[model samples]
Target: MLHSKSILSFVLVLFISGCSSVVLPIDERALINDIKAKYQGEILAPEDLKKGDITTYSFPPVWGFNVRSYFSRDGSFSLDREFYRFKNEDRGSTIFEHFIESEGDIEKTGRQIILKNRIAYRKYDSSSDLNYLSTFKECEFKLGTCTYKSASGKDKKVKTYFENGVWTSEYEGFRNSKLIETKIYHKSGLLIFSSYKGLIRGNTSYSNREAFEANSL
Candidate 1:
């Protein structure tokens, strides 16, 4: 699963960028508590669920500086990520550093939860085989925010909440925006799930969040 993330990051290094949105800073602890309080239905314990009783579960992100949560369920995880873009004279789409903001991910498998966020900046070169230059920054949660070291030597922080097992995030991509992609996920118990990614925002998002393993933090 991590490999897929790596491959995606690698490919985006070849793209360019645009303008971004205003993302506020968030507290990880406060955010987790809010999720637990709001989406209690999806996190049913064994004692709470009888045999044949259909139940779903998804945990809130734990304390500390991580965006990932733990454990399993019948709930789903929906993610909306942004990548910067640039258009060339030939009408080719590229991602450049000066464009704006990009990066984010949230996923759960078995009992492990992982949070991934990276801002990739590429320098466009039309005459070169590799049209873009490689420059990237992976942000980590700290002090209630995701801190990123920008290409200009400035520290930037961006925060998006993962509530009720749904992650709806926005990125202000390229100055002249054309398209944006978003992914919706539906996970059944035992990790069986379906995902759809597209340019238009999805309306299939559900807010049924839960945690199956009662004691599994």
Candidate 2:
């Protein structure tokens, strides 16, 4: 009963959103195992995902919620991606703006698939998190654990990214649970914005995050 409820909820998210927002895991087998344990279902094998048989594919490098791969029975895949963004603040908006897509297979070092898409979004539309702007700040964050000291004279344990060396971004009262209230900060750490979010969902790394981090140094 619990398993059925979980599957139903996942389906309801697809139905309500009218689109897939789920990210694909790099280890397809782990996803397969998770399905078996959680909902007792399975997805197509990497090579077995054929056109029409699959609508979601996430290959290494090209991996994301982005539509990818049309595997044929002979065990080859095709690349044809065209991700678009909202236009004019409308739902089911056809005033879509064309953005960058893959130029070649996922392994090319020169490929700008991730970078170009980011630029398009940053230009024509505003960045949702403005994560790129963190570069200009006094300090920046990476994945690590840290303690947050609150003004109330309390210490909270958090896997907080960094205050990297700044003070404002720390969690005020972090408790270990699925949802965590996040405190956002300006480049100078003067501005403060706070919001409630599910930590599991917010933990998603953007497509270009790895490359950006490498180049940040």
Candidate 3:
């Protein structure tokens, strides 16, 4: 009877161990492929791309713009795209204006879609966190020279404009009703020049422009 009880207890221990060791199967490659196919664009794999694990993609022109895609362990993911204009051209590229093109979770449910969420567009005067102007939105998308605004209520207005050979964005609600504006000039998706304007507290204005000449040293 003692031997029989010892065998029964050992079996029970094995059973419990087996149950605890169970792990859900995860196919990281499958998830990455699905995301690539849906976007229909070449996604530059991150430097840390590994097998059977979470990965990130950083697409180019790697300067002045950033588009990052993150794949999580739970099969969930998010894509964030941003554009920046240079501020300190004297010492090379520095961020002056930052624009969030799109940022949201990409869920796979027969069809992949970026979940609608509140996103803000911010413009800064320097490298600091002093945002001079901002715009709020529920959803915004760029299609060629046009942007579709699906954000409802007061923030539903579209404020970006593309004219001739330049793209301009403006914001007007920050720090005592200050106004901020930025203009971007690019060729082949590379920034060539950018300019900024902002209103100060004493009803004065501040502005700067940085140009990147091709033949300049």
Which candidate wins on lDDT? 3
Rank order by TM-score, top first? 3, 1, 2
Model 3's number of clashes is 0
Error of 1 at 5 (Å): 20
lDDT of 1 by residue, 70-104 (tens): 11132233323222111221122222212211243
lDDT of 1: 0.25
lDDT of 3 by residue, 88-109 (tens): 3222222233334433432211
- The TM-score obtained by model 3 is 0.27
Per-model clash counts, in order, read 27, 0, 0
lDDT tens readout by residue for model 2, 121-194: 12334343322222112122323455444445456444444232222222322233233333322221211222
Ten contiguous residues minimizing lDDT sum, candidate 1: 1-10
Q: Worst lDDT window (10 residues) for model 2?
A: 208-217
TM-score of each: 0.20, 0.19, 0.27
lDDT assessment of candidate 2: 0.26
